[model samples]
Target: MRFAWKVFLSGILVTVIALSLTAYWLTQAAFGTALSQEKQKALDRMRMLSVVVESMAAEYSFSSEEAELAGVMRSAATGDFSSAALFSKDRRALYGRAGESAPMEELFEGAAAGLCHVILARDGGYDMHMLMPVQLGVATGYLYLAADVSAPFALSDEMTRTASLITCAAAVAAGAALVVVARLLTAPVRALSAVARAFSKGDYAGRAEVRCADEIGELTRDFNAMADSLEGHMRELAQQARRREDFVASFAHELKTPLTSIIGYADTLRSRALDEEERFRSANYIFTEGRRLERLSLKLLELMVLDRRDFPLRDILTGDVRERLTDALEAVLRGKYGVTLACALPEAAVRSEADLLQTMLVNLIDNAAKASKEGQTVTLTGRCCPAGYRMDVADEGAGIPEKELSRVREAFYMVDKSRSRARDGAGLGLALCDAIAGVIGTELHIESEQGRGTTVWFLLPYGEGEADAQ
Candidate 1:
């Protein structure tokens, strides 16, 4: 069943059982008390009559005393008393009502030593029979009084009916009140269930809004937290899937461009005889496109190898890093690209594979050179710190926009696609750098402002000899 109904019915059932038992006990106890009180009243009247009889017997003979007692008892008869009788010790009727007396010995045999009483029910009316031993100086007899108890019985029955009605009414009221209380108690649970259903229907943003200082409130808080975590993870997975799709599409397009050019030109060179100048131009174009394809293939291979290969790290000084970066940038600078580079290096040993570190730095510096204008200096800066050695490649180039910075590290994602394509950039430079940084336990941090410049930096873990070098 639903939680609210379970709580409501459980509370109502408990109240009904407890109330039923209480009503039954109280009604029976009240009935018993009323019956006892009526019996006591009958006993008291019988004793009073015995006193009057003994007083008369003190001044008269046995027969005369008996006769006078009968007359007195008949005169004393009221609606409550139905009959009165006197019996001898030997079990014979002496006076009072005719055909109603019984053997005294048999009546008193099972009774106690003193006065005794019993309630006799007949024709829906109750009669209390009270037996007492009578004494007049030297004579002894038994007095029996039968008092009609139908009035007390009727009162008791009326009370029972009234109590039953009250009990039933109270039960209904208690059930209603308990239902309200159960609803109030289970409100938080129901809210949580609703949110859970919404979540099942793919609404990850739905949350329970119960707020209190109880276990239910704690559960609500935990459920909301779980929903938030699930939503965040799903968003990350979706973004990753989109990025993968974009990377495949871009990589295929890049490959197809060079292949189409190479195929078309080779077919021309094979199909027709051309002038020497035209022939050299087609051959040079073919070779140039072929070189670009080679470069793209090599970069892709390097990225795959770095991802799968676990290289052992060793300490390499910052001076060595500067030398490697200079050597890698030498060819690009020599062809009158007019990109000047300035180096500011501090002496420190960084803990990393020398080759991977060199690749990361070369990609960064090459990217900076490509982004810079002729004669706009690129600075290679380094410093030693407590935690590691830091390097920054700052370029006086058109800076990337803030919104595109976060996505620039993704493979085949470019801030300026046309410009990167003109420079033979496959847009895998930063992706390579980022993978290298992760393998070496670091992160690539990029900061740039539009129209000013871009700075790419990261920290390498300090080697054992780094402190001495610093």
Candidate 2:
């Protein structure tokens, strides 16, 4: 059954039962009081009739014969009594007729002792019979009186009918009220259920309104909280999916360019007889494209490894980190790129995964070198700050445009695509640095002005072993 119906029926059932019992008890009590009063009235009238009969019998000098006593009773009997009878002291009927079903022997025995009355039920009504022994001019006689006392019983029946009608009316009214109450009480639950259904159909914005400060309202709040969390997680997952899609597309395009060049140059060298200069040019092109492809594959592999693994950090002197980064990049930057390398180191220790930190620093400095002119300097600097040890790679290269800075960390995103391709840059350097920074529990911050230069920096929190570091 629906909850509303269950509530309504239960309320009605309780109302009917309670009201019925109360009505029955009240009617029965009233009927009992009325019947008692009626019985008393009947007995009082019977006593008065007995006294009148005694007075008449004495005044008329009545005999023990049935006809004489019957006349006396007929004259004396006036109110309430339907019939009167005279019985001899020996228990024989002497005057009026008595009921054959009446307890005559018992009535006679009671009268011989004292005045007595009994109410008897007969034919859907009641009769009160009274008997008493009287002295009739030295002759003992018994007077029997019967009064119809069914009025009180009829009144009781009427009261019962009225009570039943009242009980039924109360039940109906209560049922109507209960239905409204049930619906009001369950309104929040119904709203919550509707919201849940909508949410199941992918409507994450749906939420149940809290109507009151009750348990049901608390339930609605909890459900809304859960929905909010689910929606946020779903949005994050979708963003991750989009990033993956973009990464795959970019990766494929990068591979295609390098592989196409390598294949074209190799096919040219293989398929035709060429001059030494042309042959050397094709071979060199092939080798450069092959090297670019190799670098792209290695960077992709490193990115994947970073995603799949967790790196543990340990204390390393900031000076040592600077030396390692400078050593790793100085030869390539100064010799190959003709870029001057400079380092400004501080005496401090930072928490970092050594290999990952070095990899990230190398990428930053290499990018700095690539962006700089032959005589320009790429400077690596370290400073101890309250928050952490800050490291920066500042380059006097052509700075990135403000519009392209936001996307520079995306894989294969290059500010100057032609310039980058000419320098064999696959545009994965900053992307790889960003990933490494994340693994080290930090993030890369880049600052650049269009014509000035670019500065890439990160911070590593001070480590516990700072005092012992060189």
Candidate 3:
């Protein structure tokens, strides 16, 4: 059964049982008291009748004939009495016919000694027989009186029936109230069940309404919280799936461009004899595309490693990081790219995985170098801030548009595709940097204008007790 019905039925059963027992007990007790009173009234009447017979026997002489004594007995047998009889000292019935087939000898003997009474069940009712000794002149007689005392028993039966009716009525009334109460109590549970069903059917927004400050309400709240968490995780999983799809498509496009160029150039060199200049040009094209392919493969490998592995952070001095970046960037940016590399860093210990941090910094500085023109400077600055050791890479190149800044970290997503391709950029540098920043428990914050410049910065927490490092 449903929970509400179970509760209702259980309550009804309890109410019926309790009311039944109470009514039964009350009816029995009242019946017993009334029956006792009826019995006492019957005995009293018997005694009064015996007194009247004794008075007559004393006033008149009844010892001469038995018919005279029987006449007195018949007169006394009036209102409640069913029958009356008289017995001599020898146990002879001298009055009305005896009603019950009892041992008269024993009754006469008991009467001679003292007044006695006995109640017997007869004809689905009760009868009380009283025996008393009456003195008649010089001799003594026994008066036997039988009275119908069945009215109390009849009343008791009627009371029992009435009690049963009351109990049933009470049970029905209580059952109705319990039905309402049970439904009210379980309403939240039903709502929660409905919400759960809807959620299972992919309606993540469904929620239970809490209507009371009970355990069921708390359960509803907890279920809503769990649903929220699950919905968030589902959305996150969907986004990850979309990202993987984009990454795959971008990866294929990057590979096709380089591989197609290399293959075409190689086929031309192999199929046809060309002049020295044309041959050199074809070979250089093949070599350049080959190099680009190699770079793309290395960046993809790094991204895969970052996704699959966990890196442990260690204490590294900011001065050492600055020196490494200068060595890695100064020669390439100045000689080849015609960009000056500038570093202004303090001596401080920051917690970071050394290789991942170096990779991130190199990518950022290289991107900055590529963005700048000859004599334009790419600045790498580090300082001790309240949050951590802060590092910024700023370039005064034609800055990224504000709209494009958000998507620049996506793999193979470049603001100027042709310009990026001319500089051998596969658009994976900022993507790799973003991944490295996540490994170091941080994120890149990039600020850019349409034409002014772009600044990319991130924070690394200070080493243990090394916040004051200088």
**How accurate locally, in lDDT, is each candidate?**
0.73, 0.78, 0.78
Per-residue CA lDDT of model 3 for 1-470, tens digit only, reads 89999999899989988888888888889888988998788788878887888877775565686777777777777766547777787667777755665556566667767987776788888877778887865688787887777888888889889988998889889988998999899989999999999999999988889898889989988999999999999988876775565456545544543454466668889999999999998788677556645665555454452243455688998888887566445655776678898999888889997766876787788788778778999998988888888899999989998788789998878888887787778788788678768878888999987666789999999987796643
lDDT, candidate 2, 209-280, per-residue tens: 999998988999999999999999998887677656545654554454345446666777889999999999
| N/CA/C clash count, model 1 | 0
User: What's the TM-score of every candidate structure?
Assistant: 0.56, 0.57, 0.57
User: In candidate 3, where is summed lDDT lowest over 10 consecutive residues?
Assistant: 300-309
User: What residue pairs clash in candidate 3, if any at all?
Assistant: none
Which residue segments of model 2 deviate by more than 4 Å? 51-67, 99-125, 132-142, 236-247, 265-470
**lDDT for 113 (candidate 3):** 73
Cα lDDT over the full model 1: 0.73
Task: For residue 345, give model 3's deviation from the true position in Å.
Answer: 28
Question: Can you give the lDDT of residue 402 in candidate 3?
Answer: 75
Residue 454, candidate 3: Cα error in Å is 20
Q: What is the Å distance of residue 27 in model 2 from its true position?
A: 1.4
